[model samples]
Target chain A: MIYEEVLSGHQQELRRGTVVMAALATLETPGYGYGLLAVLEKSGLSVDANTLYPLLRRLEKQGLLDAEWDTTESRPRKMYKTSQSGRSLLDSLTAEWNYLATSLNALRSEEPNTPLKELP
Target chain B: MSSLSSRYVTAVSRSVPESQREDVEAEVAAAIADLREARLDAGTPPEDVERAVLLELGDPMRLAADYSNKPLHLIGPDYFPTYIRLLKILAATVLPVVAFAVMLGKLLSGGDAGEIASGGIIAGLGVAMHMFFWVTLIFALIERNPGSKEAKPKWDPTTLPDTPPGGVRLGDTIAAILVALVAVAYLPWQHFNSPFTDAQGQSMPTLNTELWPFWIPLLMLGLLATAVLEFIRYRAGGWSWRFVAINAILELLVAVPVVWLAATDSLFEPRFIGRLVTEGWLDASLHLNVTIIIITIGVVIWNLIDPLRKVRRDTAMRAKRVGSLG
Candidate 1:
């Protein structure tokens, strides 16, 4: 329960920043909305449309994404790719995220009795 | 096939802007359709596919709304406080330019103080018009998009008040009308002679002409038209292509004329620009002012036209697609 509470709070927020990176990384090859969602789910980061659609728009607005409509099929799909700016941002964020992960892991390991202490 | 999948897709397509919606809808529908097809291909009964797809798609309105990229706030996402704030700033900045332009015009035209004041206010109003239209547009788009965080700092959904946002109220309207009436009352006469004298002591040329060459009136008219259009859209709770077409037409009608007049020096006095160049700022500021005005006009045209072009192109494309589909 404590682990769940911690995950739903601080850990989730920290992971939230990764959504952009995850989205950008997945979208580098040009994926549509549902396509990206499937990729996210496969990668263990579930994204709802309510979050992804707006995030995509925001990223595009910020010049981090380039999108185009593919209408060759029976239905059309808007495909998005990472822009040059997004690539750069993603690179930086990835490095920072890795560093944070390492640092957090080190801290967790340093506290040898941390998990034991949390027991009721 | 169950009607649910078709209904769901149709609903999703509606909330989204037409230009990109087709592809979006296709992707979504195809995803569902593929599943249905697979079930049939796998020897599963087709009757159950509709229920499954409908259930998976969830509420048509919410799914479409989410897909539409409409903002989360009740007030809407397309509207932004920062945009409004910028508009106010632009309005403030444009007023002085208008005042200076009108004052110089009045002095050149040999108008009374009242005429100068009225012209200045009109100029301010013109700037206000541009501020209103562009700002409203930017905010409206922001409001429409549920995903925009541009207004995140200022807009709060959980605590959003039940009443509509307060803007220019009845008192403000009355005040504006009174001001306009004053401007009309203080109109410059046809025969008021110029007070400007060149450094060489020769009398400056008269400023009297058929009209004032300021772009303010056109900007005002565009704003007024847009306001009326928005009011209609507001009451109706939706927008139509016809409304957009009318808005675009109004913008062109007002902007093109005012810009033409300002560029040609036909509206104010024929001699206004000439005197301002020859007499004001020893002519350098006149050149600079003209450049600034031209640049401003260019920017306004670009900003205003860009959205209209997108809207028109998207709407046309949608129509073509729908036609083809039929």
Candidate 2:
């Protein structure tokens, strides 16, 4: 029998890189942390809020995201958006993801032990 | 402010740096409030929702560590090898030497068995503590440095025992910093409390007073930089061309101005020279100045050449070993 937890753990690992790309893409519309969390969940990336919040802060530290405390509400919320560098990063990450998918698919369909052709 | 959510938030905020505490606290509190409201709106029981929210957020201390980019450990694994190696070397070399020296000194002073034994043991313990404190402090700082994290290469078991990962001795680094610090302190001390006195009996500075406002402090600043560079070179571990370049730059920075000043007869004070000449301890034939220039240039050249040789030797040794293995 397949272990559900094991499968989910692997699934979580697979989703990890995608989650960064997702958050960077979502925050381009300019939203606060909790709002970004909801958007990620809606898109089928159920990132733990604990993980997402810290990650957002880390990205901001790396200059991949810009953050400002929005004081419009009674409680101030820190809003984040992808920076110019982040936009470029998101695009590159997206291209790389697609390239990986294509490579994986090619391997799957490949007949056993046919020598791998060097990339052009 | 005393609510469960605030409590949860405060736990994390308190762990981060104080400057970030207010901001992190406010942000975390707002996040927790948002989570609780969403959970409550879904018709979950109030108690369960708040408890679940806190549980999902996980350990506040860990979160704070992540937020502040502080490692949970005192010394990270990257520096652990060098740290262990340093302690082992100290235990083998310094501790026994210091203990024996103290015991000898105590015996010469006609101390009994009890006094000698106690003095030796105390001296060993003091030296041990001093070494441990400094070595651990340096490794901790290196671990905390952001560049250390990025520089962490993937560990390959096959690369085991490949030339000592850390090139320089920990003793050398500590010695550098200590010597520089003592020299820096000695400057100020000698300025005020010099054994050399004027005709009116005021203690006069040994170094030329005219060099005071600019050159002396510049020399001290250069010493401080040398100390910092020593620490950096030690932390960086492996010998390289880069370190050799930095070494040369630093040597010139300290030595050039010094040798130039000495050569121009501008380094030592007139009073000190007068005292030496009047006492027939020296001639006016530029003997001392020439010696100073010779020693300074010799040291600078050795300092510059030695590291370059080590880096080349290490690289060749590694290549030869890899070839032999193949």
Candidate 3:
């Protein structure tokens, strides 16, 4: 049980950074909250519906995502897509992530016996 | 369209801003409907899907918090340190001084020891509650209104001044100790051979001589503690939790006896007051005891306010430095 809790915590920390990247990548194509959730799940990032909805709203509010209500559908849906600035931010973040990943890989190769320090 | 979905939307809308309530309600409702449609397409029963979709959305209040983008905390991390520092200053200084005043007032008015103590405690607590309520309310308002001018400035290490070698200067501490020593030594002597004398050639001491045995020793102990605190402050160079704790203890030690003396009406020499009142040297109706108590309370308040003001000045200066750098 303890090991499971620790593993879940580590998984959460790992997913935290990817969630933003995943959201930006997926929202390049306009999608509503539920549809975006499905997309994220298919992409192996299973975010809670409540979490995704708010995150989408926050991103839109921050001008990183553009949102529009598609009333042509039977049920009106607030569809979201990545904004121009959001695309630029995504590019920068991607570059940073790649650099960080490479550095981590180099470190791991150098010290195979050293374990990552646990967060308090 | 489901009752459960409607209820959930209503709960969320209630907690959001009045201007955005309608928009939020419509958006949340649409999201729920979309989830229900997906479930129905997967062959789930309508009633089960409705319940499941609402449950998956989680708590409405938490959803509202995210929607608002405002802190749920009474005091956010930004202003929390300032809040704590202000609280300590009030607790150490304002509380004891107010308590002392109330006790003094009760004593002059002929209140018994128990009555005086209780009154002082009640008054102290009242002031503390008042301080806490207003402080929390202001901080909460600042938290809710994020872009307000009262918001904490961006922190920078360069903004911090080099900490002085000691918080309390050696000269100041020595001067205070000397003054305290004089006052302590003079109290007993003054009790017996007061500068003021009656027509009958008997010395009319200001304070009741009967209280000397208990009062003088207590006063000496308090002064000694104060001297030690000053030394500690001089050595430490800045306010720490330990320094604040010791300061509070010393304040209480000093305040209790002074308060007790005043409350029990044992501060003034009755004979001296009576002689003066009879000889027309003093006004018969003048509330000398009450006036003395008021002066003591005023002095305590002034002392307390002075240090707090300096701390505030220092904080403002640092904030100004950071602002300039930005």
Candidate 4:
């Protein structure tokens, strides 16, 4: 019973930071909350609305995402677009992601009997 | 916004700071409406969408917490390990030492058993509570304060302890030999030119003069044996089972008899006790024999266990290295 919980916990942890990276990258183009969620979900990156909304505000607070009220629609919505810093952050995060992917692949390909050191 | 969405947004916004309150409420209301609209457009009935959207958003209090950036945990992962490590250190070290001192002070000052127990236990618990409370408070504060992160010393692998291979440290052996030699010299010197004086002004050794014939010399021999054993340990560079056995025997040879003699009130000159009492140093009726015996027993137990523990550790370390090499 606990094993399932443990596995899911690990999977959630693995996806946690990637959610942030995904939001930052996708919001480079201006998008409303629902649109952003749908984009993320369609890309197989499901995020909780509660998590994403606060995270968007936090990113804006950190001067990463610029928020604007769009009253053009029948219902007013907050549109978010990544700021210059957010773009740079996304770039660095993408680079880090690639590096990690390569490292993980290298590690996975190694035989079990191989010396246990130097993941980095 | 629907009533449920309005309530959820209200709940989340109330806890947010006023500067951002109206903005967050508006954003949440818009998001909920969008969610409801999208689901309704996808052919879900309008009645179910509001509650579903609110449920999908999760608890409003958690959303508020996320916005406020205050961690829900008192001690998070960053500081938890350090907090626990320091707590264990305080428990193992400061708590016992302070408690022991409090108890000893109460004992020496002649408290009743209840008073001693209360004084020591209460003081110990108070210290432990303060250690925990303050350290936790400090870590919690540090966790919240962003600047304190940089203030912490950066950990480096070089700081790891690198112990030498041999079990018998040269300094320890030398110190042990010196202690034995000093006791050997001091015993005879004290016997000859005694420090304490009886009522007649004749020098009286603090130790019973009667002990000089058999017990004192035997104790001296034990000390000499310890010195020889220490020297052998130093030369051998590690403890074998044989060495540990002999070390235990040498330790018990001195400690057991001394503890027995002290317990029987034969170790000290009776006159010396009376003199101390007259000087108002010790309570006249108090029994010091138990204290001496306990301390001696504790020391002997420590002495016997220490070498054996070290030897076991050294053997394990050696075996690990050999296995790894093979």
Candidate 5:
């Protein structure tokens, strides 16, 4: 259980940065908070509503996300989309991510060789 | 809007900034409605969905913190170190001095040993609490004020002072200031009434009343100087030659008058001493004058050596850093 907790913590830390990138990328198409959560989950990036809602508001405040309230349906929904600046930020972040992945792969390949044993 | 949804919106809006309240409330309300609608479309019970949605959003206060960018802590990590440092300084310096003064006052008033001990403890705790309350309140204000600049400036590794090993903390200096203030304020007040009296009904003051006009003002001035010096030392974060010089001057301002008063046998009323001696309450052979003078000189010498030692330690650290770089 402790090992799982530690693993989960490390996983959360790793996913935190990726979640931001993924959110910005997915929000290129306009979506409400709940709708966006579904899209993110379907894409294998599960985030809590409490976390997602605040992130959306912070992104809007930073001028990286645009939001509009649509009252056309029975229930009003606040739809969010990536701003032009958000798209630009997404591109730069993607480039940086690629560079990091490539460097990490290179370092992994340089590790000392180990013999693999067949499972009994 | 449903009752739960409206309640959540109200709770969040109450904690948020006034300007952002309406917008935040509207956004939260819309989010809740969307969640409810989605659940209803999927055939989930309306009652179950409403409770689930609010639960998923977690505490309204925490949500409000994220929206308003206000920290949940009283003093944020940024200012916590400095706050604690100042607190320690007060606890070390001011607490002991206040305790000593109260103990002395009780003793001179002919209070029993237990009463003196308890009185000292109460006074020390009271002053320490006041120091803690005010310091925390100030730091909390700084943390909450969005317009307030950062307490510490941007860091540059090369320019940063080397952390002296077991260095004299900023708290010690602040404690000194607090102690001085207590002493300056308490001495005059305690002197106003005689705690002792002779069988002939003559009142005997703690200090000679004649020393009031010349001694009190000079002592206060010296204390005020120490306060100013401590304030500067706190801001600088470490010792320098300049701090040492100012500290020496202030120590002299305080120590000279004290030594002079003791040497001239003007610290305590001679009549009071004589009466106590006559009553066999005090030893006739006791050299009260010489004892006080020695104590005053001892404190002065100690104060002078403390800053000089810190200065030397700082200098040595800097030289080591330079030597390594070279």
Candidate 6:
């Protein structure tokens, strides 16, 4: 019932789904899980290894992500990328999201609250 | 424990698949290290920091659940309500029956009626328990919407088993039934009809109960049918509502003989509850009987619900995939 707790939990879950798409989008150029997390954070997404690792797996399972081991370093790191199918799906989801957002905005603007009048 | 940590990580890693473990462990290890560093920055005591980090990591059971996308309960969201309702209904039927069996055992042993509450209270509690379970189940189901990824963790099927191993094979089930027959049928019949008498010349209760011969074969046949069905499942891809249908048929078959015996005053004498009070051995026998019936029914219903629900889900998923392609 704590408002901050509820807000943060809700926000965390909301971001988790998008993390897959984000990872794939970033991995259009090959990056590992930690690398992807860093990219996400740089892009203002703020993902951690716990969250990113599972998202990577889910995306890979869906055949939207592909991985290969990079053992050249002292420790091997699995690098991932956006698969062909993944790119196509990402494009579709992105377009659909934008369209949905536009429609939602139109619907909200028509509401009788007169907040539009108060706005410059 | 710090030295053992890598082993623990490796064990957990192996518990998943070989392909995913190393990277997953590295990430997990990094997160642990990060938490440790953060604790150090906060100037937390060294001893407390390790414990805090461990606690913050959460239980490995939950971590595995997170990784595997395992729901808290065996049943999925869609069928959870119906499953809970069925459990409630079964629990309702089972409680008073068990209570009655217990009460009968007590009564037959010359215990006071006051010691046993009337059947109404038991029945009511059973119904209430049933409703409570279903209500919670319905709420949980309603809460599960794919649109809302709120508590839904992203699931990767590649790291998980294609199918859960939580199924009873027909052969093993058959073997269990055979064991039950030996214990319930052969041993008791041998004891009851054995030519030898005890020192007091009073024979053990043995298989003198009229329900003995009929119940044994009836139960065994039920189990045998299940074994055969599981065999078919192992050999083939599809085994639909066979488990449930078979169980229901067995229950009906057993019920008829049970009702007849009870009505004719041959069984349920002084009630199974009265027997519990009268003969401690009888109490134990009834306990075993009730346990077997309850377990069989539970397993059958669970088996029935999970597969059919999965079939529906897979069908829906396939449709979605096709739709997406189109």
Candidate number achieving the greatest DockQ relative to the actual structure: 4
- Candidate 2 clashes between residue pairs 3 or more apart in a chain or in different chains: none
Tally clashes: model 2.
Answer: 0
Over B140-191, each residue of candidate 2 has an lDDT whose tens digit, in order, gives 8888888887776465677456565436678877997898888777767777
Worst 10 residues of 3 chain B by lDDT: B309-318
Fraction of native contacts under 8 Å reproduced by each candidate: 0.15, 0.78, 0.81, 0.93, 0.78, 0.04
Q: Write the per-residue lDDT of candidate 3 for residues A23-102, one digit (tens) a residue.
A: 99888988888988888888778998888888888888889999998989776889899999989989999999999999
Off by over 4 Å in 2: A1-13, A61-63, A66-74, A114-120, B99-130, B145-326
Sort all candidates by lDDT, best to worst. Answer: 4, 2, 5, 3, 1, 6
Full-model lDDT for every candidate: 0.64, 0.83, 0.79, 0.85, 0.82, 0.61
What's every prediction's RMSD, in angstroms?
25.3, 22.8, 11.9, 8.8, 14.8, 20.5
Kindly list the per-residue Cα lDDT of model 1 for residues B48-148, writing each as its tens digit.
76676567666666766555555545444334555655766776677677779888998799999899888888877777777787777767666655566
lDDT of 5 at B90: 86
Q: Write the per-residue lDDT of candidate 4 for residues B221-284, one digit (tens) a residue.
A: 9999999998987776577788889988989899988887887788877787788788786853
* TM-score on 0 to 1 scale for chain A of candidate 3: 0.89
lDDT of 1 by residue, A1-120 (tens): 898998789977867888999998888898876678767888889875456765776688789999877788666656789999999999998898889889889868877887678899
- Candidates 3 and 4: which is better by DockQ? 4
Position B278, candidate 3: lDDT:
83
In candidate 4, list every pair of residues with a backbone clash. none
lDDT, residue B190, candidate 6: 51
Error of 4 at B322 (Å): 13
| Candidate 6 to truth, TM | 0.45
* Poorest 10 consecutive residues by lDDT, candidate 2 chain A: A111-120
Clashing pairs in 3: B107-B263, B167-B237
Range of the 10 consecutive residues with the lowest summed lDDT in candidate 4 chain B: B281-290
CA lDDT, candidate 6, residue A16: 65
